[model samples]
Target: MRVHHLAALVLACCTPAAWALESFVVKDIRVEGIQRTEAGTVFSYLPVKVGDTLDDETAAAAIKALYATGFFKDVRLEADNGVLLVVVEERPAIAQITIVGAKEFEKDKLKEGLKQAGLAESRIFDRSLLEKAEQELKQQYLSRGKYGVKITTTTTPLDRNRVGINFNVDEGRTAKIRRINIVGNENFKEKELLDVMVLRTPGLLTWFTKEDQYSKQKLAADLESLRSFYLNRGYLEFNIESTQVSITADMQDIYITINIVEGNQYTVSDIKLAGDLLLPEEELRKLVKLAPGDVFAREKLTESVKLITDRLGDDGYAFANVNASPHLDPEKREVAFTFFIDPGRRVYVRRINITGNARTRDEVIRREMRQFEGGWYSTSKINQSKLRIDRLNYFTAVNVETPAVPDATDQIDVHVEVKEKATGAVMFGAGYSNMEGLILSGSVAQDNIFGTGKFVNLMVNTGRVNKTYSLSYTDPYFTSDGITGGFDIYKRVLNTSALSSVSTFNTDTTGGGVRLGIPLNENDSIMAGLGLENTKLDLGPNSPQRNIDFVNEFGRSTINIPATLSWRRDGRDSAIWTTSGTTQRVFLEAGLPGGDLTYYKVDYQLKWYFPLTSLFTLMLNGELGYGDGYNGKSLPFFKNFFAGGNTSVRGYNISSLGPRDANNRTLGGNKRVVGSIEILFPMPGMKNDRSVRLSAFLDGGTVFGPGGTRPELEGFRYSTGIAVTWISPMGPLKVSVAQPINNNPGDNLQRFQFQFGQQF
Candidate 1:
């Protein structure tokens, strides 16, 4: 009898007994067992309301409707004294989420993932959704080669019908690739195929590059590269059969295998151009890269199509399409290609929209864009505008989008977006040198002050041998015509008493200058400046005759007005780590007739870079300077040139490589020459990084005194070294290790040199 009553209650929850309940009309509806949910919510979901007959189908429909709301765990219905009672047990809401022992991923990132999977705070909890979230968390670790990662979720019930979900994670060690095998390669060797893949077995550089770890994304890219290799090698029907990745029981080792099929080789038998050829057939035919009797190269075929399309775009056809169709002869092992050209209607830009420049003024960026509003669309010009904005160095990134205007087939909008970067810096640095002992410096500068496109800087340097202070300001576009203007004020103090090979002397100089730069063309500019300086020379007891003579003849101090003119042309792809470009400058400085000393100096510098390969660049640099006195006045010793340092030669002490006095003290020279050749490459373990650079260089340079004081030919020095430059978080750092190839006796050698916090 008890079992029969329990079965009747179960049946009553799912459906009512219509024969017994149809006679009873529901007088009122009441809800029970709901802690957070309102009674009206239950009443709204009930199909049979007050004053309506309660039947089996109506009761079943009401239960189904409440369950579909996803807010309840259980629902029950009962009839008592002609009244209906609806009861619901609400699911607990998530009050808090905590992740413990997470290192590889950030806590916020994990929480965000959980939120996307419907397990966030204040959301009704579901056990099935929690299981999916856990599986997803494990998969993320698996993608990073952490096969042994373990995750456990526990819910702690709280007051107000809420629970806290805690995810305890144990991220195990990354699995290392133990072996990689390439199968079914007939023409190519296994080693050849593996060489092109980024993933490799554990090696010397594996820790930094992480190339020994298995990644699905990296594997996909590697497969595509493999396919391209065979297709470019005349295997026209190459395909990847399968790839398998397996891990060991302990999750410490991984093995990958790739199976591929390389079909028969094919050669090009003929190539033709079909369809609408808006230009002359001869003109378009010349752009094709493939020829008869050549191996079928997929890369060349793709390039030919792009070239044809670009040519059409140059002539105001922005929507041109060029397709290549190949006709294959299986038995003959030959292929014929026909390129179909479709030159669509010429489109114009309806508008050019600039956005994302919250700090920089609109005019500051608009002046760099080459694409104009309401102009004929040119792909090259639009692309050039993007590159120009990128080169400004004020923005971290620049992006462009072309969206066709709705209901206007002949017009499109060019949307440009830019992300600004911090252009101001404050730096303090210290370094140790064998000769100078220790040096300290500091600077504060802003390249784009308040987004006005102006520059300002203040610098101070205090060293054992050299001390300087300077302030400068520049207006890049000073006038409406794009002229550049700037002013500088400086004070310098140089003491040579601590040098082993230089005369013991001290000099103080104070000067100020104003300059204007005029642009002649995109790559060329002319700069002119005028300055007045007062220099005081103090000669020690053991000072050289050259210094003593200049001080005795010109008095303790002298004033001079100097005028300078310079022409420069720069075409480098990047100011730092340039790979291809030519830069040249010619500078001339002369003292005016009113000055106590009348002298003139000429300088020339040229630098060129050639990209020898995709990964290697060859660079050449040369500099020459010559100075002489005019109107029977001698060139001031304070203005003489000195060499043998970071900016001149790398293997000798600063300014310690010139003519020597009776005390073996170096005397400044009037002429200087320098040249260097270097091969630049990426640093190890950072194949595509641009912020750091490494190079092997050979440098040769010398300085010569005036008249009969010039040294012998052996005085010229040569050095070979390796150099590294890194744009670290603090600032730019440069380090070089060099050995003098032709070190004569008495030549001061400095084998290693380095500096940090260098200005840009």
Candidate 2:
């Protein structure tokens, strides 16, 4: 009788009758209406036991637990003679997900994004999750300046209680920035302030550069740039008050407004240092670039701090900290600064770890590291080591991090990560040049062979003007002391009949040479080699008198034992695009004993890149060449120096700047002088792209000394021109346009010249 009353009291778990029910023992719990979910799975989620007393609270708890699992859409309880019956209606599982009209991103990518939001295929479908996924998708489009995008989702019920979801998307056009206004600018013009920002109104290059696209990240960066511009120019109290961004109704145009407060400019009243005197106070004071009455520029202060810390780092204080404290006088518009230095404990390298070099041996990278294990940890050494590894060119990237060892304050581990690139090439290609005609070429070269730091190359080329076959090998670590050794063998044939501008001659040369490199220091090296070459000359009737004289004296064919020595100091920051370093090279080639002709030639060249501003670079170059014969032998006419081309004296013809023979033909001179001054900048719309460079140059060169020094060296042909260099997908491309200055009547002036080569 009591069981019947309990069963009757609970019509359903959520009913009011169940709330008034009395406690009763549970006999058996059965779960029904679960198709895809297992009966055992339903039992695991039941919170009540068979022997426990069941009441309104336990029944409600059971329903809440089942619903929380997200596997059921509806859950209820039924009572029958003290037996508990739990019924669940399972949610439909997603069988498949499809996307349509997704052109901005791949369909798989969109599905992946939905998966992150818990709305993937073969998962229990939830309307809330679907809503969240749609919002996330919209955010992605918005980030790309797409203010007008539409997404519609559909649900299709499939067999076996599964459903399919389809999302239709329409990616609209990108919004462009139409107006940018800077308010409250007192000292600088609005245009002047806008010029420093990355975001701008539409311009001629906006289509390619995409700067007209409004982006939140770019706007933030522009604000920071504005802050830096003011802070670096003595406006210590500059502040950006607010910014407003708006889009048009059609979502095609955007407007940005920035409000700023440019406070009083401050000058340095006095400067002082308050820190540990690890170095002499006078030296540290000298490192401070600011003086009394100097404008208070934040950049100057920051630079001073960095210099102090770097100086400390050189002495093994790898974690040195330098900070500045400023004192402001509002009335006088003056500020004073005090630099505080803290020299951290001297640390030594505990171990050097290498990673990410799957093919290259660790020793190849280790050999380039200047910082060794179990040595004093010098920051400069660590930086230099990374630079050296990057300069290897075998790896695409090299990175280093000094992580402190656990429980070891005085020791740190240097972790070097490198990304290896393809260092070998098998090439078969054809190229054409205006001067050299069609050329067929093939090469098998490896800069890093078999996980070893060695180089080997075999090359063959056939062209109208030249043919070459060569093989070479080099082991950079030939000796334990960083000495390098290499050997080369080559046969070259040259035919200059097509080169009407250059002096006419032809030769078939065969030679083999062995060389060694001795490292003078980290940035300097000396290369010495001895070669044996045999040359067979072919001179036509139109050849210069000097070529005739050479064939007559050397009997049409001659053997030469040439000794070559070259000293190079390369301190440039980059070999490809240098900006602020000096490079100097001196080379000497002399005929040694056991040679048919005894002669010597020397060339010296210097290049300096001085950064005049952040965007402008001043480059100065000088080259001098002198060659003559010894032991009563005239200099080899074929060995003479030739100038005047894209490389030197841009307005003149190729190898056309020099003395003339008795027949009034262009004969190359034994002496040459070339100097150039240039201002280089990035190409338009390609800021900081190292592969392309543009420059305005002043070039001057003269070749002389075929007859006498005074008469031959009298005139130095000069030209002012604009040139561009691009490390294009093919090869190095150079174009120049020049106008000659102080023209001579018979000069060969070429106003424009361009050279491009293809490699495969």
Best by TM-score: 1
Q: By summed lDDT, which 10 consecutive residues of candidate 1 come out lowest?
A: 1-10
Model 1, 103-222: lDDT tens digits are 989999989999999999999999999999999999999888899999999999999999999999999899999999998999999999998888999999898878998999999999
Candidate 2 ranges with C-alpha deviation above 4 Å: 1-129, 155-167, 426-442, 498-504, 575-577, 612-621, 643-667, 673-760
lDDT (tens digit, per residue) of candidate 2 on 478-584: 99889999999999987767555555678999999999999998899999999999999999667866677778778878999999999999887765456789999
User: Clashing pairs in model 2?
Assistant: none
TM-score of each: 0.83, 0.82
CA lDDT of each candidate?
Answer: 0.83, 0.83
